[model samples]
Target: INFNDIKEWKAALCLLRSSPNLVELEMLARPEEDNLVRPGVSFWAESNQFDCPFDQLRVVRIVDVVGIRPELDFVKFLLANSPSLEKLTVKPVSNDGGLDLLKELVRYRRASIQAEVIYVDP
Candidate 1:
């Protein structure tokens, strides 16, 4: 789904929980304002609490992810839940924390899933 607002994100997350046959998910977000600080751990914890239907998911791509805590949580959730996932791609917005985000990705890579992370220099 093309995420334009928080409402869209909420809806998408709900849909992901209900769709039992979901094989692939691609989340694209448009750039916006408001740099509110959200705790990444809480966001990830909440997402992990849900029963996501991603057991069959093989490919997940998140595009245009800004430095938002929710975005980081979302990536972390995908990494943890998508055991069968073969490919995952993330494109982060150019900002002060690009290197930090890359480090997090590297640190979270699963041994079972050969995750390839590419950060576009901006």
Candidate 2:
């Protein structure tokens, strides 16, 4: 997935929605190309609601996150929806704002009591 591709982001969410038995999921941002453009809208919005919980999802890994709003929102959305999630590992692009990003990630409401949010350095 490209960090700024709105279509890819939305499609990923839709795929997750349909994958009820999913266990481990990984989203890694490809290294940016010179032609990449930022999306005009956030892929996951606060007003949107999911019809079902991710009951079988146990692990999630997101890499090279730039700490953008959409990415953070997606993380929050996943945290809120994945009732069976046990671990979520996030690796940022760099150390810049890493602390703040970790704080924001931890602040989100998680559906699983045992879910642990892990922050990894670049």
Candidate 3:
């Protein structure tokens, strides 16, 4: 689960999906040996599938999210799916549009859900 391979990441998601009672999900994506050959493609795709069957999930923390379309989509998906979600923490490595992402989430927060997003710029 510590590797950057796409297959491994997908497998992790499948495993996670099986757990319907998961209340918290944390994900960290690190490059393989500091190799920048790929520009966050693997993480992006994995993020898109972040919508697990965690009906009671309230916390989701993502660290080191690089600039990837799937990552953005994943965050949006979480905001839409996790009605009980209350907190979201994002730690970005660079200027990866983290603020804009949070704003979007805030804009879409439902009146019934008191969602708070804490963005830590790194």
Q: 60-98, model 2: which lDDT tens digit per residue?
A: 999999887777878888888888999999999899999
Instruction: List TM-scores for all candidates, in order.
Output: 0.73, 0.85, 0.64
> TM-score rank, highest first?
2, 1, 3
lDDT tens readout by residue for model 1, 61-121: 7777775656666677777777677777777656568788788776774523665655665
Q: Rate the local accuracy (lDDT) of all candidates.
A: 0.66, 0.82, 0.63
Best by lDDT: 2
Instruction: Tell me how candidate 1 scores on lDDT.
Output: 0.66
**TM-score-best of 1 and 2:** 2
Error of 1 at 120 (Å): 3.8
lDDT of 3 by residue, 1-122 (tens): 33445566567667667867878989885545544325646563346455554467788898887644545545665665676778877777677677776576566543226667778787
